[model samples]
Target: MNRRKSREIAMKLLFEISINTNDVSETIENYKENNENFDDVDFAYVENILDGVAKNNEFLNKTIEGNLTNWKLSRISKVNMSILKIAVYEICFQEDIPSKVSANEAVNLAKKYSDDKSPSFINGVIGNIIKLK
Candidate 1:
């Protein structure tokens, strides 16, 4: 199902949605149009991640905020938040995927899309969640 691709698309969409609350549907449509190769599975994954995050944002943030070792949710960059939200959503709700896989994917995304320190920070936060469980 190309989970990595799905995670990337989910992160991108979440970044946009977090910045601009309105026009998320339009944005998703535009993303689909740009990535014509995205099959139904990819589309569904992206949609589910976005929908899940949106529906449980408060809970997700609370989970994330509690897991932070030396940071606050407010201080986290939007890019990191996007990655963390997806990983956290999967860890807490999407029982099919292993927590380690979700966490590693999130760390990879943070490394690619955020600062040098982001990968470790993301890994640590996701790891903390796993420990809490």
Candidate 2:
């Protein structure tokens, strides 16, 4: 599958876990049962992202919460928030990914999965973060 498609699946799984407050194992099992097309690498990426987010949630949330304007982290859509978290994690910890790529991918994910305002909002916040970092 394409990278964007992989990211979308990863984001969706992350959001579902966030909304449902489900464990990673359960989520992975559910995905395995539900998505016939999922492969090992795709599962690996999703697991890595989810684990990274969980491991660094406090720092990630604080970073994201700081960048957002007139909005609290809790107030963001689950989809948008998940997208941001994964991208921000990539920016902060995944040195292999360029910060610009992470930010752009995040904005695209926001546009694809969130409201009309979400893409720009994501871009602005991520831009601010890249600048500050």
Q: What overall lDDT goes with each candidate model?
A: 0.89, 0.86
TM-score of 1: 0.93
Give lDDT tens digits, candidate 2, residues 12-54: 8899998898987788889888768655346667778888988
What's model 1's overall lDDT?
0.89
lDDT of 1 by residue, 14-111 (tens): 99988887455777998777766766347677888899999999999999999897787899999999999999999999999999999999999988
Clashing pairs in 1: none
- Poorest 10 consecutive residues by lDDT, candidate 1: 34-43
lDDT of 2: 0.86
**Model 2 ranges off by over 4 Å:** 39-41
Indicate the worst ten consecutive residues by lDDT in candidate 2: 37-46
Model 2, residue 45: distance off in Å is 1.5
